[model samples]
Target chain A: MPHLRWARALGASALLAVLLASAACGGGAQPSSGGNSSGLQVIKIATQSPLSGDESVQGIALKNGAALKLKQEYDQFKAMGFDLQLDPQDDKGDPNTGVANAQKLAADSQVLAVVGHLDSGVMIPSEAQYHAAQLPIVSPANTNPNVTSQYKYPEISRICGRDDVQGPVGAIFAKDQLGVKTVFVIDNITAYGTGVANAFKQKAQEIGLQVVGSQSIDKSETDYSNVLTQIQQVKPDLVYYGGLYQGFALMLNQAAVRGIHTKWMGPDGVFSNGLVATAKENAIGVYATSVAAPTNLTPGGQKFIQDYTAEYKENPDPYAIYGYDAMGVVLQGLKDAIQKNGGKLPTRAQVRDAIRAITDYQGALVKVGFDSIGDNIYAGYYVYQITSANASTTGDAKLMAQYNPKGELVSQ
Target chain B: MSSTLQTLPQLVLDGLVVGFVYALIAVGYTMVYGVLKLINFAHGDVFMVGAFVGTEVLRALTAGGRPLSPWALLLAAVVAAAAVTALLGAGIERVAYRPLRQAPTLILLVSAIGVSFLLEDLVRLVESIHLGKFVLPVPTVFATVYRIHVAGLQNPLTIRLNSIVVVVASILMMVGLTLFVGRTRPGKAMRAVAEDRTTAALQGIDVNAIIALTFLVGSGMGGAAGALFATQYTLVTPYMGFDIGIKAFTAAVVGGIGNIPGAFLGGILLGVLEQVGGGFIGTKFQNVVAFAILVLVLVLLPSGLLGERVQEGA
Candidate 1:
C-alpha cells in the first residue's frame, strides 16, 4: 500500500513534468502547409519546429529558411512536371508534439521529406515516425552524434556537423592559433555537454595538450562557485565549457566576479546572441566552435544571407542557412530521384535512396555528402571568437578558423 | 596546504548564499506543515511564479535604459512578486486544499501534486503569451563584487553584492516571521488553530482565516526569496522551482517539519555540506550528498533537528 502511494506520487510528479515540458513547445504558420500543388503530381516538404513557443524564434526561422528554398525551387519542380509545395508543422518543441506532427506528416501521401525540429531531443524521437513513413528528414541544427549514428536511420540525414567533430575543432584551433598548452574541461553533466566535453578532452590529450582537470556541474544549479573554486585551484591556462550558452554565460559572469580570468572556450552550444546578452562584456574574447559557419563566411552563404534577408525582410538566425541547406539537400534528392525515374515523380523510397546515395552535393553553406549512416562526410566545423559587434548582432561572431571533419586546418 | 583546503573558504561562502535562499523557501514549507499538517506541494511552483513576476517587473522598470537605483528596483521586484504569490498561495489553498481537507492523506498529496503541475503549466503558458519566453534572463540588480584577500590563498575570496543582499533579506524575513509568530495576536490565533482546530474555534479564533493567513505569510516569504534568488542567480525558468523546492522541502524536513529555526539551521547545514562533500566526492555527486544527509537525518532523528513543533506552529 505504501509502495502504491509512492508510485502514485511519482506518477503525479511525472505528469507535472510533462505538463511543464509541453507548455514550452512552439507552433507557427505562413500561407500554411498542404496548399494546392498547382494541380500537378505534388511533392510536399514538411517542416517540424516549435513554431509558437519560446523556441519559436529559432523554429520559425528554420521553417521560413526551408520555405524560402522550397519556394525558389518550386518553378524547377513544376517545370519537371511535378508540383513542389511546403507543409510546415509546429512540433512545439515537445516530444509528444513533435511526434504528433511527425505522424501527421507521415500520413500525407504527397509529403516526401522533412526539414526540422530545432532540438536534438525532439528530432531524435521523431526519426522513428519519419522512418516508418519512408520519409527522409534532414536536420538543420541538431549536433548530437547519435543523430546519424544512433539508429543509422537511413531516412535521417543532417547537413550540420556533429558534436564529436565540433569539439576537436576547438582543440585544434586552440593549439594552432592560440598556442594553448594546458586546459581544463567543464560540462553540464547532460548527454550533449558531457559528450562534447569528453570529445574535447580526448582530442586535447591526443594533440599533446595537457588536460589539468575536468568537472561537471548541474545545469539547473544557480550557484557555480563550488566548481569555479575548483577551477581557481587548478589554474589551467584555458577552460573549456561544454554546455549551452546559458550555463557558460553564468560561469563567465561568476568567473569575472571572482577575478579568475583564464581563457575560456566552449563548443557550438555557446554560440548565440543570448550568450552575449546574458554575459555582456564577459562574452568578449570567449572562444566558441560551431558546426555551421557564419552565414557571410562563404560566397554561397553570403548569397543566402542576401536572398534570405530580401525574402524574409530580416536577418536570418544561425539556423536559417542550415535550414536552407537542408531543404536544398532534400530538393536535390527529389531531383535525382525524379531524373532516375525518367522525369516522372519518384516514390518516397526512391527519393530516400537517392538522398543516401549523394556523393557530392554542394549547398549554400556546406557541401552535402552523406555516408551510409546519413552523416555529411564533408561536414566542416568553424571556430568563432565573440567580438563587441557580436554582442549587438545575432550571428556576428568573428570566424577564427575552419577545420575539416578530420580536425585538419582548412582555413583561418 | 591542500588545494581543496585553500578552496574551502570560498566554497563555504558560496554555499551560505544559496543556503540562505533554501532557508527562505523552507520556512514556507515548515509553516504550512505546522498549521495545516499538509505538505503543500505546489509551494515550489509558487516560488517560480514569483521569480517570473519579479523578473518581468524589473524588466519593465528598466526598459529603454531607465535610470533607477538597483536597490529600489530590487525592492519593487520583491514587493510585486510577494503580493502576487501571496494571493496565489491563498487562492490555491481555497480551491485545491479546502474541499479536500477531510480527504485521505494520500489523496491530499495527489491534489497537491496536481496543483503544482497546474501552476507550472499556467506560468509557462502566461510567460509564452506575455513575454514569448518561459526562460527569462533576470536583469542584474547588483554588479559590485567584493574581494577578500586571505593569508594562505592567492585568489581573493570574491563575493557578489547581490549575494549579500540575498543573505541579509532572508535573515530579515526569518527574524520577522519568528517575531510575528511569537509576539502577535494573529500569530497566537494561528498557533491555537495548529494546537487544536476544535479548541481554537471554541476559543473564538477564526480558524479558517488563521490557516489562510499562514499560507499568505509563508508564500510571501517564498516570493521574496524567489526575487532575491533571481537577482543572485541571474536567470529563471518555469521549472527552476522544482529543483530548489525539493531541496527546500528536504531542508524543511531535516530542520523539523514544523519548526522555523530548524529549517534555517537545516538549510545552512545542507548547503555547506553539499559543497564540502561534493568537493571530496565527484561534483556529480553533489545532489547525492544533500539527499544522503536527509536520509541520515531521517534515520537518526525522525523528528528532525529543531524537532517538528506541530503544536508550537512557529
Candidate 2:
C-alpha cells in the first residue's frame, strides 16, 4: 500500500519535470527542415562553438556573427531562389561535444558549410567529421597552427592567423615594444593553449628573451594560487598566458591579489569582454595579441558594428568580426559553387573546393585568400592593450601593432 | 626541490580554503548517505543552484544602486543561497526521493541521478531564459588582498580577503552543523533514524521529518559553500558542479561515508594533496592526484580515515 502511494506520487512529479524540461528544450530547438524540392533550395551553414560554457561569450558572439551574416544574405539568396539558414550548434567548448555536433551537422546533407569552433582544440578534432562529410568550415577564431597546417584538411580553414605567427608577434611585441626581457609562460592545458605557449616559448628563446619557466593550467579549474606563487618566485619580466580569456582573467586577478604585477600578455583567446569585466581594474594595461585586425578602424567594419549592435542589442565580441569574415568566406564559396554549378545547389565537395579556392575575396573585416592548405594568406594579427575595462566589448583596445600572416611586423 | 619547498606554504594555504568548501558539500553527501543510505547525487546541482541564487542576489543588489559593504553583500549572498537551496533540497526529497522511499537501492540511485540531471537542466533553462546566458559571472564584493610575509619565502604569501571570508564562513557553518547534530534533540532523532529507522519511529520520533531535516541542514551548508565558492572564484556555470561535486563526493568517501568530521578531514587532506601534487607534477593533474590519494586511502583503510566515527554518529 505504501509502495503504491509513493509510486503514484513519483510518477506525477516525474511527469511535471518532463513537461518543464521539454518546454525548456523546445525554446532552444530550431525548426530543422529537411532538404526538399521547395521553391528555395534550403542550405544550412552550421556553426560549431561553445555556446554554453566558460567561453560562451566569445563562442556565442562567433555564432551570432555567422548567424547575422546568414540572416543578411538570406534575402539575397532567397531572391536567387535559394534558402540560406544559420545552424548554430553549441559545442560546449568540449572536444567530445564538438565532435558530436560535427557528426550531427555532417550527417545533415543540407549543411554545406560551417563557420566556427572558437577553440583550435575543438576545431582540430571536429575537422575529421566535416572532412568525411565534405563540409567546409571557415573558422572564426581557432589559431593553433595544427588546425590547418598539421591536418592539411582542405575542409578546414580559418579567417584568423595561426598561433605560431600570433605567438611570435606577442614575443616580438614584448621584447621590442613592451621592453620585457624575461618571460614566464603558462598554458590552459588545452591543445590550443599548449600549442600557442610552445610557439611563444620557441620565439622567446630565439629572440634572446629569458624563458624562466612554464606552467600548465587546466582551463576548467578556477584556483590559480599555486601558479601565482610560482610566478612571484621566478620574477619574470612579463607573464604570458596562452589560454582563453576566462583563465587569463582569473590568473590576472589572482596574481594581482598576490602583488605579482609582472606584465601580463595572452593570445587572442584572451581577447574578449569577459576578461575585462571579470578582471576589472586588474585587466588594465594587460596586453593580448588578437588574430583579428581592428574592426572599428575600417569603414565597412563601422557599418558592421552598427548593424550587429542594432541587430543583437549587444556589441560584437572581438571574434565576432572573425565569424563575419569566416561566414563571408563560406557564403562567397557557396555563391561561387552555385554559379559554377549553373545556379544549382552544389555538392559538399564543390563547396569545400570552392572555399579552399578562395583568393583575394574581401569580407567585411578581413581579406581572405586560402593557401593550398587552407591557411588564410591575408590573415593579419594585431596587438591590443586594454586601455579600458570595456575594450573587448567595443573591440577598442589601443592597437599597439600589426603583423602580417608571416609574423612580419607591418606597422606600429 | 628547494623551489617546491618554497611554494609549499602557498599551495597548502590555497588548498585549505577550497578544502573547506569541499568539506561543506561533502557533509551534505555524507549526511544524506548516513540518514537515507542514498548518495544524493543531486547535492552538487543543489550547490550550483545556490551559486546562481547567490550571484543573482549580488547582481540585483549591485544593480539596485545602493552599495553595501563587502561583508554585508557576502552575508546576503550566503544567506539567500542557503535559504533557496535548503528549500530546493527539501523539494527534491519530497518529489524525487520520498516517492521511491521503499524502492530498491538501484532504483533510488537512478532517481537520484534523474533528479541531478533534472536540476542541472532546470537551472540551465531558467538561467538561459532569464540572463540569455547561463554562465553567470559572480559580481565582486571583497577585493582586498592580504599579503603575509613568511620567513624564508622570497615572495609574500598572497591571500584574498574573500578566501579568508570563505574559510571563516565554512568553518562557522561546519561548527554550527556539528553542534546541531551532536547536541540538539532533532539531531539525536536523526542519529537514531540513521542507526535504526524502525526503532526511531517507534520511539515517538517522526522518521521522515528527521530525514527531511537532515537534508535541509546539509543542503543549506552545501548552498553556503556554493555561495562562498562563487565569491572566491568569479565564474559560475550550470556544469561547474559536476567536477567539484565529484571531488566533494570523493572527500565524503575518503572521510568515510556517513561520517561528518571524516568529511572535513578528507576534504582538507584531498585539497592539500591535490594542490601540492599539482604544484609539483602539473596543475592539469590536480584531479588525478586527488583521486589517486583517495584510492590510496581507500586501499589502505577500506572503511576510510574516520569510518569508525560514522557508526558513533550520523
Candidate 3:
C-alpha cells in the first residue's frame, strides 16, 4: 500500500511538470491576448536573394546594405512603437526556388514584409505568391517594367527606375550624343536582356538610326570572335549589347581582338564595374546605362557608401545603394501603417496597402514613390563610361556622365 | 574587299588563341586515360581547386596591396597553384580510388562522380570566406593589344603574352615529363606497371607509388592549365571547371586516351572546330558543334586519333 501511494504521487508530479513547462514555453497561448509585459514588439521582415550563383556578387552587396539599414533603423523603429528584424534566404537567383521561398515566407506569421527576388526572371514567378499571401515585396534591382505593370495585383515594388526608361536613354545617347548612323543590336536572349534590347532598338529607330544588324548569343559560350568578325563586316558605327557582365566582358575583349573598334554600349545588366575589370582595354570608350546615380552622390547614399567602405574596406556598388533604399521603404511603410491602424499590429493586407500607397518615402538612394502598379515614380536613370588600362582595378575608371530620365546629360 | 580578307585571318588568329587554351586543358584528360583506361571525371574540379589555390597564393603574396611586379606574382601563382593541385590529386587517388583498386569499371566511374561532388561542395564552403563582390586582380599584360593595319583597314590586334607563356610552359613540362618517363629509374617502373600490374608487382615495383606519381603529374598539368585559363579568360568561378572538364574529356577520348601528344592534338582540333563552328553558325550552337565533331571523329576513328591495340605476350 505504501509503494503504490509513492508511485501514484510520482506520476502526478511528472504530469504537472510537463504542464508547467508547456506554459513557460509560451505554447498553447495567443500573442493577441491582452499583454501585461509591454516593451518593444519585434516584427520580422524576410526576403529571398541570390546569395550564391552567377549574380551572387550583386546579391551579397544587396544583403550587406540591407542588413546595415535594418540595424540603423532599429532604434528609430522602436521609438515609433515597434522593432524590426531582418530574415534573409538564399534562392541562388533561381525562379523555382524563389517561388518556394515566397511560399515559405507566406507561412511564417511574424514576417510583415519582404524586399527581394533581385532577378526579374525569379521575380516574375514569385511575385504572384507574395501578392496572394499579402506579403509586400520590394525588389531592389529588378527593372523589368512588366514585373509591376503586367501584373494585376503587384505586391512587388522597387526604388530603381525601370529598364523601359534606361534602355531608351542608351539608344538616344547612341543616336544623338555619339551621332551613330548605323547600329547593330545584340542580346543574350534572357527576358531582361530581350526586353531592354527591344526598348533600345525601338527608340534607336525612332531617333533616326538604322538598325543594320541584330544577333543573339548565349551566356555559356565564351568565344565571340566569329560574331565580332561578322559584326565588323557589317561596319556599324556602334554595337549595342544587352546582357550581363560575364558575356559582355568576353565579347568586348574578343571584339577588340577582332578589330571591331565600334563603340560598345549596354544596359544596367552589363554596367558593373566588374565588367571593366574583366575586359580592361576592351571596355575603353564603352558606355552603359544605369537606373541609380553613383552612390557617392545620392542624399543618404553617401553615408551608406562610407559606412560600407569602413566596414567592408571597399566601395559599395550601385546595387548596394538601391538595396538599402528598398529596405528603408519596406520598414518605413510597416512603421507608418502600424501607427495608423489604432497603434496595434496591423494585418499583412494593411502592410501591403501601406507599401503601395508609399509617397515620397525618403530613402538613402532616392525618394521612393510607388505607383498603383508598384513602380517607383520618382526613379531616374544615368549613363556611365568605362575607361580602364587593365582588367583588375575598377577605381581607376571614370564615371563620365549622368543622364536624367529624359536622356539629357546632368550637369556635374 | 581588304576588310573581308583581313577579317578571316583575324578570326582565325583569335580562334587559335582560344583553341590553344582548350588544348592545354584537354591534354590532362587524354594522358590520364591512356594507361588507366578510365576517364578521370573529376579532372575539371581539380583544375578549379588549382585556380582557388592560385587566388590564395596571389592574395597572400600581394598582402597590404603592395603591388609586386606582374611577372613575380605570375611566377608565384603558377608554381604554387601547380604544386598544391598536384598534392590534392595525389591525395584524391589515395582516399577515393586506392581503396577501390579492384572495383568494377562502373564502380570506379561512380566514385569519380562522387569525388567531383565532394570537391564542388568543398569549394562552396571555401567561397564564403571572401565576403561580397570580390573582384580578382588580372594583369593587363595578358590581354594587351597592338593594332595592325591591313588593306588600309586598321585591324585591332591582341597579342596574348599569356598564351605564349602557356604554350612554352606546357611544352617544357611535357618534355621534362617525357624524358623522365623514358629515361629515369621510376619511368621504367611506371611503364612496366602500366603494362601489367600483377607482373610489375612481381618485379618488386611499388604499384601504389607509380599510380600516385601519375596522378601527381596529371594534376600538376591540370593546375598549370587552370592558372593559364584564368589569365586567358580573365574570369574565375567555382563551377567554371565543370563544362570545361567535359570538353577536355571529349578531347582526350577523341585523341586516344592516355596518349600525351594525342591529347594535345585533340584539344587544338576541338578548339578549332568550336571557333569555326561559332563563326559559321551562331555562337549559341558552339557546344552542339563541338559534340557533333566528337561524334564524327568517333565514327571515323573508333580507337581515337592515336590509340593503338596491344596483343598479350606471344
Candidate 4:
C-alpha cells in the first residue's frame, strides 16, 4: 500500500512536468511582440535551398554568401536600433520540401524577407505560399522564365538572368564562336532543364545550327552510357546539356568511355567549381554559361570575393556572388523601409514594397534593377571554359566570353 | 552497321560493370534476409559507412602528397572498408535487431528503418562536425590506364584498370562466398541456421555465432562494394547508400530473396536491363523500367527468378 502510494505520487509529478513543458512550448511558439525583453528589435532574412543533398554544395555556398552580407551589415543595422538575423532552410531541391519551407518561413512572424529557392522547380510551387504571405523572395540562380513570366506573385523576383536569355546566349556562342553547326541537346526533364533546353534548341535552329537529336534523361540515373551510346550515332558537333553538375559530370564521363569526343556545353546550372571537381579530367575543355561573371573579374566583385575568401577561407561558387547581391538588395530595401518609418523596424509589407522599388542598385556582380515582372534588367550570361581540371584550386575556370541581353557575344 | 548494333558491346560492358557492383551489395541483402527473415534496411547505410571508411583511408594515405599506385590504393580501400563494416554489421545486428528477435516481424522492420535513418544522420552529423562540410569529395584513387579497342569496332571501349580490378575482385569474392557457404564448417552451420534456427541449436550448432558470421560476410561484401563504387563515382555523400541499397535489395528480390546465386543474377540482370532499356528507350524511364521489372516479377513469379517457392502453414 505504501509502494502503491509512492507510484501514484510519481505519476502525478510526471503529469505536472508534461503540463509545464507544454505551457513553455506554447509560450515559445507565439510570435514575439516587436522588441524582445532586452529592448533589441529582431528581424530574420530566410534562405531556402537544397542544403542537405547532392546539390548542397551550391546551396550551402548561397546560404553562406547571404549570411556573410547580413553579418557585415549587422552592426550598421544595429546603429539604427535593429538586429537582423539569418534563418536558413533546406528544401533539398524538391518542390514539396520548398513549399513546406515557405510555409514555415511564412509562419515565423520575425522573417521579413527571403533570398532563395535555388531551383526553379522548387521556386515555382513555393512562390504561391510566399506570395500568399506577401513575403518578397529573391532567387539567386533560378533561370526558368516560367518562374517570373506570369507575374503571378508580385513579391517574387530573381537577381539572375532567365533561361530565355542564358540559353540563347549559349546557342549563339556554340554557333558563332565554337563553329558548332550540328548539335545534340539533352535535358534532365526538370522545369529548369526543359525550359533552358527548349530555349537553346529554338535559338540553335533559328541561328542556322541544326539540332540533330534531342533527348531527356532522368537526373537520378548515374549510368548514362546507353544514352551516350545512342548519342554516338548522331555524332553532333557539340553536346548541350541542361542539367545540374551531377548528371552532367556522369554524362561527360560516360561519353568519354564511349569515345564520343564532342565538345560539351551546358547552362548556368552546370557552372560550379564542384562540377570541375566532380568531373575531374573529363571537365577539361567543357564550356559552361552563368548569368553573372565571376566575382574575381570585376573591381567591386573582386572586393566582395576578397572579403568572402577572408571570411570563409575559400572561393565562392559562381552563384555565391549572386546570393550576396540578392542579400544586398534585400538589406538595402530594409534600410530604406526603416529610414522611411523614422528609425523603427518596418512591417513585412513595407519591406516587400521597398524591395520592389529597388532600381539601378550597383551590386557585386551587376547593376541590380528589376523589370515589370521582377526580372533583373541588366542580367546577362557569361561563358566560362574549364582551362584546367584541377579541383584543388578554384582558378581552373577562365571567363572566355560574355553575352549581353541582346544575346550577342561581347568583348570582356 | 546500325548505330544500336555498333554500340551493343559497350552498352553491355557498361551494364555489367555496374551490375557486378549491385550484385556484390545484393549478396549482403540476400544472406541477411535468408537467416533473419527481416529486410535489413540499415544494410544500405552500412554500405554508405563503408564508402566513407574507404574515403578516409585513401585521404590519409594520400595526405603525404605522394600518391599510392592505383592497385595499392584499391587494396587498402577494400581491406579497410571491409574490416570496419564487418564490425559495424555485427554491432548493428547486436544493438538494433537482436533485441527485437522475438518481436513481431513488423516491429523488427520498423526498428531496422529507425537504425537506417539513425546511421545516415549520425554519419552526416559526424562528418559535418569534423570537416565543417557534409559533402566529401573522393580523391581520384584509380586512374584509367588503358583504352582497349576491339577489332571491328568504330569506337575504342574504355578499359579502366580500376573497372577490371573491380570486376575481378567481385568475382573472387563471389566465388569465395559460394565456396564458404557450400563447403566450410561455419558455412554449413549458417546453412543449418537458415534452414531452421531451433533445429540448428538442438543440433549443437552455435546459432548466435552463425548469425554474426552471416552478418560479417554480407557486410564485408557490402563494404567492398562501397569502396569500389566510391572509386568509380569519385563522389560520396551520406545519402548515396539509400539509392544503391534499394537497387541492391530489388536485385536480391528479383533474383530470389534467400538465394545467393539468385541475388547475383538478379543484380546483373537488373543492371543490364536498366542500361539496355535506357539505351533503347529514353533514359527518362530507366528508373521506371527497373522498378516496373520488380512489380512484374512480383506479380508473375513471387519467388523471383531464382527464388525457391516455400509453403506456409495455414
lDDT of 2 by residue, A247-359 (tens): 88888877777788689999989888888878888888889998887888899799999999998887888878888878888999999999999988899999999988988
lDDT of 2 by residue, B172-274 (tens): 8888888889999998998999988999999999998998998899898889889999998887888888888888999999999999999998988888888
What is the per-residue lDDT of model 3 for residues A1-412, given as tens digits with 9 covering 90 to 100?
A: 7787678668857865875575344321222333424566767787677777667666776877777778777778767667567777778777889899889999988788988866787888887888889888888888887888778475778877778877888888777678789988888877778888889999999988999877778765555666777687788998889877778888887666555678888888876656766776677778888887766765577788778788667667557777788888888888778888977888888888888888898787788888778877777777777766443334344565666655566752
Please write out the lDDT profile of model 1 over residues B212-298, one tens digit for every residue. 999999998898889889998888888888888999999999999888899999889888888887776767788898789789988
Candidate 3: clashing pairs of residues: A277-A391, B34-B257, B34-B258
* Cα RMSD for candidates in order: 5.6, 2.7, 9.1, 5.0
- What C-alpha lDDT do the candidate models reach, one value each? 0.84, 0.86, 0.74, 0.84
TM-score of each: 0.89, 0.94, 0.83, 0.92
Which parts of model 3 are misplaced by more than 4 Å?
Answer: A1-42, A79-83, A220-226, A230-235, A249-260, A276-284, A306-313, A386-412, B1-6, B35-37, B55-76, B104-107, B121-135, B141-158, B175-196, B308-314
Worst 10-residue lDDT window, candidate 2 chain A = A27-36
TM-score order, best first, reads 2, 4, 1, 3
Q: State which candidate, 2 or 3, has the greater TM-score.
A: 2
Indicate which candidate wins on TM-score: 2
Point out the worst 10-residue segment of candidate 3 chain B by lDDT. Answer: B132-141
Supply the global lDDT for candidate 4: 0.84
Q: CA lDDT of A253 in candidate 4? A: 70
Each candidate's iRMS in angstroms? Answer: 2.6, 1.7, 6.1, 4.1
Q: What is candidate 3's local distance difference test score?
A: 0.74
